[model samples]
Target: MTSQTLLSHVASILDAAGVKRGAIHDVHTNTHLLRHEVTTNLDATVYRPLFCLILQGAKEVGTSAKLLKVRAGQSLIVSHALPVVSRITEASPDRPYIALVFPLDLDLLRSLAPAVMPTFDKAASDPFSIFRRDMDEGLEDALLRYFVQCKAKNTRHLLAPITAREIHARLLIGRHADVLLRLLWHDSAASRINEATREIQSNLSETIVVGDLAQRIGMSSSAFFEQFKAITGTSPLQYQKDLRLLRARDALRATRAKVSDIALRVGYESSAQFSREYSRKFGKSPRQDRNIAPVEQQQCIADPAPR
Candidate 1:
C-alpha cells in the first residue's frame, strides 16, 4: 500500500477512536494514540522501550548525545528506557501530527530469540537505544492489523496479542533486527544497561551505588559506567536523579502532598535543593508548577515529538 493510503487508514482509526489532542491511552494495554494540533516545546520524559510510527507531520527527539528526526513513513524504535527531550516540529489543524506507540514486550522478544539467532551476527556492535528507520511494508501491515484489532472489541482480546507479537517479529527480522537482537541478547551492552536502569528505577528513593550496580550486572565499574552512558545518554546517578524528580513532579500534580514531603519521598533530603533542581530541569519551581491547571501540567508531561 502507498504511504498516503496507509496514513489514511490510520487516521480513520484514530478519528473513530476519538483520540484527543495529547497522549490518549488506547484499549490495548501499552498502546497510545498521540495527536497534537500545533507544534510543541521540547519536553523531557522517560521513553520506555517502544515503537512509534508517525502517520502525519514530524517530530524531533534527542538525548544529550544525538538528535533524531522522525516524520511520516518513518518509525522510531527505543530499545531501552531513556530520558529524552523532544518537540513537535510540524503540525496544524488541517493535518495534525498523529502517531501510535506501543511498549516492547521483552519477555516475548526473548521467547522468539532462539529462532532468530542465526539471522544476526553475534559480535555486532550495539546500536543506539533510540534510532529511526524507514517503515517497511510488512511492519506496516502488522501495525495496520494491530490498529484494526484494537478497535474491534470482540476480537481485540484474541487477536491483539497475536498481532502484537507479529509486529515484534517483523521488527526483529526487519531493518532494525540488529538493534533489537543486541537489546534482547543476554549479557550484551544493551541488556546490561537495561538491567542497571531497572535497578535505579526500583530503588529510585534510595541511594544508588553505581559500582555495586555494575557488579550485579556483571560489568566492571568503568565498563558499566561507560556502557550505561552510551545506551542511556546520561550517567547512572543522573538517570536516577531524573527519575526521582519526574516522580516528584507526578506526585505534586496528582496529590496535595507538600513539596518538602514529596522531595523527601523522592530521595531528596533538602526541600531547597529539590526546588532548585526541579526548577532547572522543568523551568518552574515545584510550587509554581503545581499551581498550573492539571490539564496544562499533563500537557507538559506528554512525550516529546520526534525531531
Candidate 2:
C-alpha cells in the first residue's frame, strides 16, 4: 500500500477508537494515540523504547542538542528510555495532529534477532536512541493490519500480537537496524546505558554512585559517563534527578501528602532544595502545581512506563 493510503487507514482507526485531543492510552498493550487540535508548547517527558508513526500533521521532538521533525509518512523509533521535549507543530480542529505509539518489546525483538538478516556493518560509534526514517510499505502495511485487528471484536486478541510481531520484525531490518541490534548486544554502548538506566530507576529513592554504576556496567567511569550522556542527552546524575522530580510531581498530584513528605520520599534531604529545583524543572512550585487539576497538568510531562 502507498504511504497516503496507510495513513488514511490509521486515521480512520484513530477516529473509530475515539481518542481525545491529548494523549490517550489504547486498549492494546503498550499502545497510545496522540491528537491535538492546535499547536502546543514544548512538553518534557521521558519517551521509553517505542515506535511512533505519524499519520497526520507533524511534531518536533528534541533533547538538549538533538531535534527531530516527524511528519506524516514518516516514523520515529526510540530504542532507549530518554528524556525529551516534544510539541505538536501542525494541527487544526478540522484535521488534528494524529499519531500512534507502540512501546518496543525487547524480549520479542531478541527472540527474532537470529532470524533477522544482517543488512548493515557495525558502526564505530553508537547512534542516538531516537531515529526518524521514511515509512516503508512493509512497515506501513503491518501497522495498518495491526490497527485493523485492533478494531475487530473477535480477531483482535489473536491477530494483534501477530501483527505487532511483524511490525517489530520489519523495524529490525529497516534503516535503524544497527541501532536496534546494538541495543540487544551485551557489550554495546546502547545496551550498557539501558542497563544503567534501569538500575537507577529501580533505586530512585536511594543515592546513585556513578562510579559504581559504571563498574557494574563493565566500563571505566569516564567511558561510561561519556557514553551515557551521548545516548541519553543528560548526565547520569541529571537523569536521576529528572526521574526523582517527575515522581515527586506525580505524587503531589495523586495524593494528599505534604510537599516535604513527597520530597523526602523521592530522596531529597532538603525540602527547600526540592521546591527550588521542582519549580526550575516544571515552571511552578509543587504546591502551586498540585493545586491545578491533574488533567490540566497532565500534558506538560511524560510518564515513563515501569521497567
lDDT, candidate 2, equals 0.79
lDDT for each residue of candidate 1 in 101-207, tens digit (9 for 90 to 100): 76777778888987997777656664578878899988888777776676667668899789989988888899888888888888678877887787787778999
Q: Best-fitting candidate, measured by lDDT?
A: 2
lDDT of 2 by residue, 193-264 (tens): 999998988888899899999999899999999988888878999989988997898788789999999999
Query: Residue 47 in candidate 1 has what lDDT?
Result: 80
What are the TM-scores, per candidate, against the unseen true structure?
0.90, 0.91
Q: For candidate 2, list the clashing residue pairs, or say none.
A: none
Q: Each candidate: what lDDT?
A: 0.78, 0.79
